[model samples]
Target: MDKRGRRRTLSEHVILDAALALLAEGGADAVTVRGIAARVGVAPNAVYTYFPDKAAVVRGLAEHLLGRVNHDRFTDPSQPWRDRVRALALELRAELLAHPGSVHLMLGHPPDGPHTRAVRETLLATLADAGLGPADAADASYLVNVHILGSVAFEVAAPPGGPDVGTTRFRWGLDRLLDGLAAHVATGPPR
Candidate 1:
């Protein structure tokens, strides 16, 4: 039964939606089982029925947010590898920036859900297509992930003069990273 004394259907999605709202309103710490339950008009235990605990709620939120990122643009074989990489980074940045309050959830608890894995796989394939061997591709993917996550974290923490400022900084850093990767590829496997 909801707060109004009428029975309401509750599901994981509903709970996650409430949690996300709380997170957006007051950051990660605000997303507790009780808080979510209240938001969704359910008892606190009802939240646990869908999520075992707060960590599970956080993970769900991370996955929910990651699911919003569009990685298809990066999977286009016709596009240049650098362009594909940039598309992916931009997509991730856009999603993270859209939910600035949830950036810490992403940084603190990386999601290993299907959406996250698909994005990672796309990045790995992009690097491989760019001539990076498996090992180098894996390392390069890590570097790219770190850069995107770190940059978004900074932008969220201290918003630049404007959206364009952060976008410019992000593009510059991404370009430099790609430049190094390109040089590495051109040099062939380390002697």
Candidate 2:
């Protein structure tokens, strides 16, 4: 340990940065303990000082990428609820599309940090502020995030990558969901 005795011997951040680069160069499959070690010019065992396995590395990458997006797009008191949620959805969609590999990693792995909870909590709080009950708020949050992930997966798995099929479909579906939310918001409340 260093003078402070606080995580001085290892640098998880460096590993994460290198792993992200490898992810961009290829995909999740391109990241391995040996590969990352080579990328960082460290011994293979050096990786185990931080991560336990390849999946753990991917999990870290997922958390890093997800955390980079502005989850606060959900709960900005400055914007109206409909516009806030729509903007949140669209912004998140664009981020995921830019890093399709991270989306895949997130879909396969469970979230392991406060950053992930922050994302969901932001969405949940925004829905509550918009007058949804807890159960309905949860469902609405699920609807938006799931569609984003599902749409990205479909795009990643598809071919003929020139038609914009996935982007067009996801945008249309997201707008329809927003339309339903607007109608609900207009009703004021259920009797």
> Against the unseen true structure, what C-alpha lDDT does each candidate score?
0.86, 0.79
lDDT tens readout by residue for model 1, 1-191: 55767787899889889988998798878988889989988789988888888888888888888888777767988889999999889988888888777778877777778888889999999999999998999999999988888888788777556454488988999999999999999997732
Off by over 4 Å in 1: 1-4, 159-165
Q: Which stretches of candidate 2 lie over 4 Å from their true place?
A: 1-10, 161-163, 184-191
* TM-score of candidate 1 versus the correct structure, residues matched by position: 0.91
Q: RMSD for each model, in Å, please? A: 2.7, 4.4
Q: List the residue pairs that clash in candidate 2.
A: none
Give TM per candidate: 0.91, 0.83
Q: What lDDT score is found at residue 72 in candidate 2? A: 65
What lDDT score goes with residue 14 in model 1?
93
- lDDT, candidate 2, at 117: 84
